[model samples]
Target chain A: MNATREELSEKGKKRRDFITLTATAMGGVLAGSIAWPLLQSMNPAADTLAESITEVNLAPILSGAALTVIWQGKPVFIRHRTQQEIAEAEDAPMSALPDPQTDKSRVLKPQWLIVTGICTHLGCVPLGQKKTEPRGEYGGWFCPCHGSHYDTSGRIRKGPAPTNMIVPPYTFVKEDLIRIGESS
Target chain B: MAKQSQNPYRHPFVRWIEHRLPIISFFEHTLKHYQVPKNLSFLWTGGFIAGFMLVVMIITGILLAMHYIPHPDHAFDSVERIMREVNFGWLIRYLHANGASLFFLVVYMHMFRSIYYGSYKSPRELLWIIGMIIFLIMMATAFLGYVLPWGQMSYWGATVITNLFTAIPWVGDSILEWLLGAPYVGAPALNKFFALHYLLPFLMFLMVFIHVWALHTNGSNNPTGVEPKTAEDTIPFHPYYTVKDLLSITAFMVIFAFFIFFAPNFFGEPENYIPADPMVTPAHIVPEWYFLPFYAILRAIPDKLGGFVAMISSILVLFALPWIDRSKVRSLTFRPISRALFWVFILDVIILGWAGAKPAEGNYIIIGQFATAYYFIHFLILVPLVSRFEKPSGLPESLSAYYKNSCHD
Candidate 1:
C-alpha cells in the first residue's frame, strides 16, 4: 500500500509562521539585551575617562576677560575679569542689583566668573558683551531675554531672571592662567 | 458521578472568577475577531519599538535608583561610583541615558509616520491624541530624569527650564517655587525632581496602556491611508500585525544596540561629566539634542512671552491635527498637493532642529522664525487649505484591490 501524504491546512501554516516570527523577534530582543552589557564591559577605560577632571589652559585669557571652553560636552564659560572689573563690580550701587553686596558668598573666588553660559530664563546662551561695553550696573553678563542681568561677579542684578549666573568653583594657578577642573 | 467529582487542584476561587469575569472569552473574541490589515509593512514597527523602549527605560531606571542617592552632595559621586564600582552599573546608566534618546527617535518617527499617513484623521483621532499625551509625558519625564545626575548640564538645564514658568503672568514665580520645592534649582529641587521622575514613568506606563487601548479600539492606521471597508479588506490581528510589529521592533533594536555599544557618548554633552557648581557658568549652555528643535522655536521670536508661546504652540498644534486637516480623502497617496505639502513640513522640522543647535544669531534666527511660522502654517493653514482644494489621484475601492493590483504588476 502507498503511503499517504498529509497536507497542512492554511490555518496550521499560519500558526507555524506566527510562532516562527515571534520566536525570531524575541530572539533578536534577547540578543540585544545581552549584547548591551557585554559591550559596556569591553569599554572599562571609558568609565575612568568620563570621571577624570580635564586640564584647561587659561594663558590666552586676559584679566577681566571671559572665554568659553567645552568640558565633558558642556560649555564652561571662564571669565578672567581684571581687578578693575571686580572692584567696579563691588563698588556698583547695591540698589541697582536685585541682591547686592556683589554676593561674594556665591563665588568660589572673587576673580573668575566660572558659570554655565545657559540663561536661567530658559537655557539660551545669552549674548556676550557687545564690543568694549562695560558689564552693566549688575556688572557681569546680561541675558538678552527678559533682560536678566548678572554682575561681573555672576550675581543676578536686574531683570526677570530668578538666580545668579552659576559660579563654577576654581583656583588660579598663576596670575594669567587658571585651571577650571581643580581648586586649591 | 465522575463529573461531580471535582479536582481539588483546581481552586474554587479561580473557577468563580473565571465564570464571573469570563476574561478568557474576551481574549478569545479579540484573538478570533479583531481585524487587522494584512498588508502592514515594516513601518508599522515604530509603535512597538516605542513600547519596548519604555519598558527598557523603566526597568533600567528602577535598577539604577536602587544605587542612586537623591541628595545633591551624594548624587554626583554616587553616579561616578555606579560607573566605576557597581557590577553592570555603567551599563545600566548608559542604557537609561541613551535609551532616552532612542525612545525619542522612535517616537518622533512614529509621530512622523502618523503625519505622513494621515493616521491622525477621523476615527483614529483619539489614538493620535493619546499618543501625543504620551509624548508630552515622556518629554517631562526625560527632562526631570536628566536633572537627577546633578551634572553641569543637569544643573544649568534645570535652572534655565524651571525659570521659564516665571514668564507666565502673575503666580509665575509662585509656580516656579512650587515646582522647584525651594527658591532655586538646588538640593530640594533635585530631590523633588528625583521623586517626580521616578513617579512619572509609572504614570506614563498607565498612559501608554491608554494609548495602546485607544489604538486597538480604533484599529491601526496603515500605510495605504485608506480605511478598511469590508471583511476582505482585513485579516486577523494575531498572525498578521503581530508578526509585522515584532519584525520591525527587532530591526530597530539592532540599530539601537549599535549606538548603545559602539558610541554611547556620541550624542551626549561632554561637560555633563563635570559636577555642577552654582558659582561658575558654562559657555554656550545648550540643551540636549532632542530638545533642539523646540529650543530653536523658543528663540525664533525675540519677545520673551511671544517666543515661549510659539515654542509651546508648536507642540500643542499637533493635538489639533485631526481637525486641522480638511481632506475629504484619508490617504496622501491619492493627494498630490497634500503630499508635496507633507514633504515641506518634514523639511521645516529638520531645519528647526538644525537651527535650534546653532547659536541664536544672524541668519539662523531668521531661518528659525520662518520655519516656525511654516511649522504652524503646515497644520493651521496648509493642511486645511491645501487638503480641501488639492486634487487627489485615484484610490482603490478596497485593500483587496490594492493587494491584487500590486501582485498583478
Candidate 2:
C-alpha cells in the first residue's frame, strides 16, 4: 500500500491529462449515440399512442350521475354534476383539504367533473364511480384497498394518499360531447 | 521477467505480440501471481461459483431469447414450443431458469459468509456497497425476466409491482403509465421488460468486473480476521485458489444438473405454465421463491406507501451496514454474542420467507410482523449493542499459529 510509482514529468503529466479528457468526451458521445435508439424503442407504439385520445357523449350521463369510461385502458370518471352536487363541491373548504384545488379549476364546466378513477395511493380504482358504493366522508370516491378519501372535486381529503386523483388531459367539444386524452 | 523467458508456455509469436500489447503479463500479474491469504475456507469459493453461474445464465439466456417472442399473446405459446418442439430447448430453458435459482442461492450463501465474517466493515465498505448494488440489479433483472413467460402469476405480479409505484405522491400515475406503456400490463409492458431484463445482466457483468477490481485492491479478509504479515502467510492464486474454486464449482454443477434433468419445475410455480389472463388472477399471486423474504416485509405493513418504503428500505439498509456495527473484530468466529445473533437473523429470514409464501392471514401475519421487526432490530440495535458489551474470543498471532493451535482446541 505504501509503494509509490515513479512520478511523471511535467510534459508527460499534461499529455496524460489531455488523453484522459479526450477519452472521456469520446465515451460520452458513444454512450449517447447508443442510448438514443434504445430509449426511442421504449416509447408507446403508434397503435397504442393513437388510442390515447377518446371521445364520450355527455347525453348518456344524467345529472349527478358519474359514468366510468375506458381511455387508454384506464377508467375515466365522467360525472354530470347536478346543481346540488356542484354547489356541494364548490362550497367545500379548499384550504382544509390535504391537496387543495378549487372545484372550478378541475373542470372546464361547472356541470362536469371528470378525473381518472385510479387512486393516488397504490393505483386501485376508487369505489364511488357507482351510485351503490361508499362515497367516503366526502360525497366522492373512497378507495377500499387503502383508505383514501377524495372530495367531489377529486382532491384528496384524508388518508395515506398524498395528492388528488389525476385528471387526464381532457376538453369539452360541445355541451353534449367531451373528449379525454387531448387537453384544450 | 528472466524466469518467464525460460518457460515454454511463452511462444515466440506470443512473445512478439506481448511486447506490443502486454496482455499476457497482465494475466500473469493479476491471476497467476496475485497473492491471497492462505487460510480462506470453502465458503470463500462461493464467489467463483457465482461467477460461473453468471456465465451459464448469460449463455443460456441468449439461447432462450433466440426463440422467445415478447408479445403477450405469443409468449406462453412460444415458451411451450421451445420446450416441446425445439431441439434441446428444454435443457437450455431449464438450465437458464434453474440457473437463476442457483445463482440466488450461491449469492445468498456468499452474502451470509461476508456478514458472518464482518466483511462489510471498514476498508471493504465500498466493495460491500457495490455488492449490494449488484444484488439490487439482480433482483430487478430476475423480476423482469420472470414476467417474460407471460403466465397468470407473471401478469398479476407485474400488475401488483407496477401498481406499488402509484403509492408515490404526484408522479405515480404517469410513471406507472410510462412503465406499462399502456394503461395495464400488456404487449408494451412485456416488450420493455424483456429489453430491460436482457440489458441488466450486461450491466451486472460490468459490475462484477469492478467488484473484482475492488476486491484485488484490498486483497481478502480471511476466516481468522487477521491480516497477513509476511509472504509465508500467503500463496499465489494460480494453482492453490484456482484448484479450490474449480472443485467447488464442480460440486455446484452436480446439483444444478440434477435440477435441470430430474426436477425442472421444482423451484417454479405450476400456475406459471398457464397463459396470462388478466381476467383471472391466480389465488396466490406470489413472486419467485427468492423474493419471498422481501415480499413478506412488504406485506407486513398495512399501509400502502409504508409497505413500499419498508420493502425497499429492507435492502437499502444494508448499504449502511459498513457504518452500523462499529466493531474492531472482523469475523464472528471471535465474537460470541454476534455469532449467536447472526444465526438468529438467519432463522428469522427463513421464517419470513416461509411466511411470505403463505397467505397473509391469522398466524402468518403475526409471524411475519415479528420476523420483520427482528430483521430491522438485528441490524439497527443488536449489532451495535452486542459489539459494545460482548468480549470477543482471543485471535491467534498468525495463520501458522492458528493452524498449530487447531488440534489444541
Best by lDDT: 2
Candidate 2 local lDDT, B319-338, one digit each (tens): 99978888888888889889
Number of the top candidate by DockQ? 2
Worst 10 residues of 2 chain B by lDDT: B2-11
User: Which digits, one per residue and each the tens of the lDDT, describe model 1 over residues B363-391?
Assistant: 88789889988988888887888887887
For model 1 the local lDDT of residue B197 reads 94
Cα distance off (Å), candidate 1, residue B245: 2.1
lDDT of 1 by residue, A65-148 (tens): 677775443456777777877786677776766555454665556666677665556644555543364344555666643345
Q: Supply the DockQ value of model 2.
A: 0.18
lDDT of 1 at B171: 79
TM-score of candidate 1 relative to the true fold: 0.72
lDDT of 2: 0.85
- lDDT of model 1 at position A88: 68
Q: Give me the runs in candidate 1 sitting further than 4 Å from their true place.
A: A1-120, A123-184, B1-17, B406-409
